[model samples]
Structures are given as structure tokens and as C-alpha cells.
Target: MLSYAGIQNPYALGKYSVEKNAKVMQRYRFIHESLLRIAAGHLPAREDWDIKVALGKHLYEDAEAADRLRARITELRTSSAVLNQEPDAALSLLMDELIHARNDLELMVGIYGVIKPALLDAYRSHTATTQQIVDQPTIRMLRSMILDLEDQLSWGEQMIVSLQQSGIYGDNGDQFKAGIASLLAAAGGIDGQQPKTAVLPHRIRSHEPYRIPLKSVRDPRKMGPVTWARTSVLNPPEDPVQRSLLAKMRVRQEEMTAAELIAAVLFSQKNMPWEFYRDLARHLWDEVRHALFGQAALESEGIDWMSRPQYTSDYDVNAPKIPGAQYAWLAIGIEEGAMKRPGKAGEFEFCRDEAKHPLMTQFQDYDWADEVVHANLGRKWSPDLIGEDISFVREIAKNELDHFWTEVRRAQAQWNEGAS
Candidate 1:
């Protein structure tokens, strides 16, 4: 018989029958959903680079965890559909409160300090209570998650400590502490109680109206307002004779980053499948990395990225309102346009042969690969949201791109006139 030293004769059989395992898996599924909701709600609303990247990383990890939990349920021969259902009412409320936190500090404290600790405790108890031999797979999964969560907790505590040292919260630390305490109490004093079934609202309420200002961009230092210019993905350089390949690459990456970031924020605001947000968040983070690649390249060339005059056109500015499937299609179109004939492949080839810069070649190669994946993602998700008419979607994407360039030219003229 499967046994452990501490497991008594009565409990040696393990706490999980098939039904019990399903129930536990269901609870874990709810927890994963809650984490995803929190990540999606907070990430787009944040402006600070540190917070944004950290939250983005956290979101990606949570998404992976959620995916794993669903797979585990299926492995146990249980219906993974329970994952699509509403989470415990109290857990949902806790997530809502965290999402609605007035500021980043409050959010960090509530999630890392209170919610995470409670979750860690519950997972520990579950692992301990579970039969080590019979439930080895589940135990192994929870243990792996525990390691990640511990790292997350450490990072969170450091963030809170840093905030305290910076005097950002001043005397309000006690207030924040009390707020966390209250949430923990409501969540059944850290160990977590069985969540009651409560009716879910028709619409999820947001703490603030989501808006992406036309001129907003995240940078490390304060710089003067830069005029936005639209550039072509097909032809990055209007005059290859004047501009270096590295320069063109940098600009292209920055512009793409801007678009990706904006799309991520807009998509997060909409009520979509959790999987959609998860995939989008991962893509958003990759775009950030791409932008950094450009930033690094420029700095290596003794160029101050912040001082460069950048221009964005009306299409890039107002693309957020295009709505639902169209928004996704815009991204798909861009990626497809870049990856196909006369596309980014040309740029990669040029960088590899003429530029002779290994790093630039490497970046472009990976970028090309990523866009292919994104195009496929767009193909997979966008059609269901709109319909299966692939040609119609492509046409809409083409028209939007044309409109975008037209706005860019007009905006350029207006900017030049104002400057002169």
C-alpha cells in the first residue's frame, strides 16, 4: 500500500478519490482564473515601466499556470469545462478589489502581500494533505507552482519595501496594512474558506475608464514632446541612401512596439476569452522586448533614443476604436504584411549580409519568426470573433492600412507647418 511516515492507517489511502480530485482541481481552476483577471485588469492600466514589465511577467506566469491546471484536470479524466465557469464569489470579490486598487502601491500590497500569501498557505496545505504516492502528479505540479509563487512573493515584498523607503506611501502604510487585513479576513483568515455560489454580474466593472492618449509613451527619463511620424513596414526607409539600415530597423521596432502596446491595452479593456488576454499579454511583453532591442542598438551607436524626433500619424493614434475582431485583424494584417512577399524577410537578409552585424541579424531573424506566430494567432482567434470569411477580413485590413498612411501624410504636413 502507498504510504508516508506521517500518514496514519485511516488516511493512508489518500484524501483524493476521483471525485475529490476533481473538486480540488475545480478550486485550482478558479484560482487561476482569478489571477488572470487580476493581471489583465491591472496590466493595461499601468503606465510605469517597472510596474508594467513586472506585472506583464506575472501575467505570463499566471497564464501558464492556468493552462497547466486545465491540462491536469483533463489528465485526471475530469471535465476541464469547470475552468470556464465562474470562480467562488468571495474569490471573485477579492480579485475585483485588487483590480480596483487606487494606485500601484495598493495593488502590489493587496496581491503580493495578502492574496498571494493566502494562496501559498492553501497550496501548502493541499500538498501536505494529499497522498504523496497516489497523487504524485498533482503534488509535483503544485510544488513547481510553489517555487514560482515564492519567487513572486519575494519580488513583491521587495517592491513594497522599496516603496516604503522612497516615502511614496508616507504614513499611509498602516492604512494599506489595514486594507490587506480586511481582505484576508473576508477571505477566511488566510487559510481560505469554501467560497459560496453568488450570481455574477452581466458586465465586469472597471475601476477607471480605459484610455490611451495619442502622445503617451513610456520612457526611462523625461523628454520633450516628440512629433509622431508614421512609417511603412513594407518600405522602412523612403531613402535607403540617406538612412543606415540600423537606423531604419530601430525606427521600425519602436513603431511596431507602440502599436503592439496600444493593441494590448485596447484588447485588455474588452471582455474576451481569458485565453485571448493571456496570449495577448505574452505578445505585448515580446513587443516590449523588441523595442528594447532597438533602444539598445541605438545606444550602442551613440544615439539618445529619447532625443530623437519621432512622429505618429492619425491611424496609429485612433486605431483603438476600430473594435473587436477588426482590432485583432489590424494586428494580423500588419504581421502578415511584414512576413510575406517583399516583407521583413528582406530586411533580415539585408542586415545579415550587408550590415554584417550579428546582433541585428539575430534580432531580425527572431522577430520574423515571432510575426509568423502572431499571424497564425490572428488567423485562429479573429475569424471566430468576426466570421470565417478570410477574404473579407484581409480586405478590411488592407483598407485600414491605406487609411492609416493617408492620415500619416496629413499629420506630417500639419506637424511641419507648426514647426516652421
Candidate 2:
């Protein structure tokens, strides 16, 4: 036989059959969905600002991985209809335990220390066994997923360490993680191919169903009133220099509400297209990044943002309402309004010209750019999700915004009266 350039041996083929590969892909899909669920579920409940931000970013990555896995799975023997089907009952139960983990430390130990590393191993095993030339597409997909998973695991490890150092981990934290690991072992590990040596562990989900938070949680050390941005003492300083400082502080602290609202929508809405979730997840992460930008800006000025109030009203009011209404209000009204004059661009120019702060100018510059994308994201997804014309959604969102500001004003008045 003539030699082929790509083959080690002309007669040899890869180890896994088509059916086997598809099953592996299904397992990957399930892991990714669980990742999405874990991150979205915790975004509102997790109090640490950095942890919340990290969850926002991870959820977006989870959504992306899930989307890609679906495409690859569809190309296999299975139909698209089976894409959402549960791969294994035990695996499903395992996820329930992770989602219902007692606290942030336990959740960290389960997800990062156990599930994620196992997932990475499964991906590596598949790639190593599969034929590279014949299964190039799957190989490529797994490669991308591996990169993202590695990055997430890196951060997850550091975060776990930070949690441990802070003395937050309960004495039972390791035992809790071990119980979860034993459950995974009973479930046949991440790939569902390992021996079921251990029996199912006790489940937190059994005691109580996991409820997504109705409002965003803030760290007690950093907690503040929802009126922080509205109060002149905290924001909108008369001095230009202080104005820029406060603006960054406002963004760093206040955008948590945006993240909380977006996560609420992702968790609550089930009927929207997968693309809607992906885009909105990205939108959620962008808001978190913007908040981080504000954090960085404040750090540059030796200001402790935790010393100031982080606003919660934006999440508090909308979270309990219909998610559709919240989405419409934010995407259509506030974000679109931000695209106009004296909004993001105006803020940028103020930092550049009046404040003459180079760091603030750069921060606002990107802030303006991000808002432009968010405005378009609102236009693209909000109308379809809300089942209304864009104009009508805009009008409705405007009314909602008006009502919100009215409440803000009323609260401000009460604060003033109390002081007098």
C-alpha cells in the first residue's frame, strides 16, 4: 500500500467508533450545561464582588461551550432533539448536589476541585483516543473547550485558596467535597465510564430546592444602600477631579445590579432561543468587566470602593418582577438612553477634558464602547423576548424607568428629612 502523509500506519484507524464518540460528546454537553447552571445560580447569591464577577465570566464561557457542543453533537448520529436529554440519571443527581451546595466554599470545592478537573480529564482522554484526521472538528472543539476549562480551573483554584485563607471554609469543607466526589464516582465519573465504587451521597437538594435569589447579595463588609448613586454626598461631586473618581466608583459598585438582573433573566426564562442566553450571558459578563474597570480605577486613586455604598436598587426592584419587563427596561430604556449625548460619550469627554485624568479617560472610553454594544444587544434580543414592537418596548421601558427614578427621588427626600 502507498504511504499516506497523515497516517502513522496505513492500516490503523482511531479507537472509538461513531456511536461511542457521540456518547462522549453528550457527556461533554451535560457538563457544560451544569457549568452554566452553577454559575447562573450563584451569581446573585455569592457575596464577594470578585467571585460574582468571576461567575459572570464563567457563565458566559459555559454558554459558549454548551452552544459549540450542541453543534458538534448534532453532526453525530443523534438528532438535535436529543441534545437536551439527560445522559445519565446519576449524573443529573450529582449536579443537583453541586447546585445545592451549602455555601460558597463547598460549592468551590465541588465545582473546581472535583467536577472541573474531571471534565478536563475526560476531554483529554477523548482527544487522545480519537482519530485526529477523521475527527478534526471534534478535536478542534475540544481544544477550544480545554483552553477555557483550564483558565476557569486556574482561577477556581486561586479562589478556593483565598476562601480557605479567609477562614471561611467550614471544618467539614473537605468532607463535603469528598461526599460530592463519592457521588460522582457512583455516577461513573464525568465520562460515565469509570467503575461505580461509591454509593450516592446525601443530597442538599433533598432538604430544600435551590432557589435563585430574588435580589443580589453584597458582602456585608461592602454592603451599602440602594440610594448610593442618587445621593450627592456619595456621587456627582462639584469638583471635576472628584467627579471622575466617583464615576468609576459608581460603575465599579453599581453595575453589580446589572449582573444580578441579567443572571435572573437567564435563570428564570426557559422559552427563549439558546442564542438569546448566550448573548445575554455575554452582556452580563460585560457589565461585570465594567464593574472591575471601576474597581481598578478606584484602586489607582487609593480609594477603597468598599468604603462607599454599592447600590442595590436596580437589582432589588426588577428581580422580583417579570424578567421580561426587567430585560425590556434595561436593554431598551437605560442602555439605549446611554448611547445618547451626556451619556457614555459625554462621560468619556468629561473625564478627558474637564477631569483630565488619563486613567478615567481610558476607562470611560471603553465604557462608552461597551455600552454601544449593549444597546445593540438590547435592540436585537429584547423585542423578541418581550413579544412586542421595539417602539412599544421602549415606551414601556421608559415608564418603568420613570417609576424607578421617582422611587429614587422619594427615597432621597426621606434621607434629607431624616438628616434635617
**Against the hidden true structure, what lDDT does model 2 obtain?**
0.79
Each model's RMSD to truth, in Å?
A: 5.5, 3.2
lDDT of each: 0.61, 0.79
Count clashing pairs, candidate 2.
Answer: 0
TM-score for candidate 2: 0.90
What tens-digit string does per-residue lDDT give for candidate 2 at 31-55?
Answer: 7777787788788888777788888
Give model 1's TM-score versus the native structure. Answer: 0.77
**How high is each candidate's TM-score?**
0.77, 0.90
Residue pairs with colliding backbones in model 2 are none
> lDDT by residue for model 1 over 149-179, one digit each (tens)?
8988999898877766766566645566566
Name the best candidate (by TM-score): 2
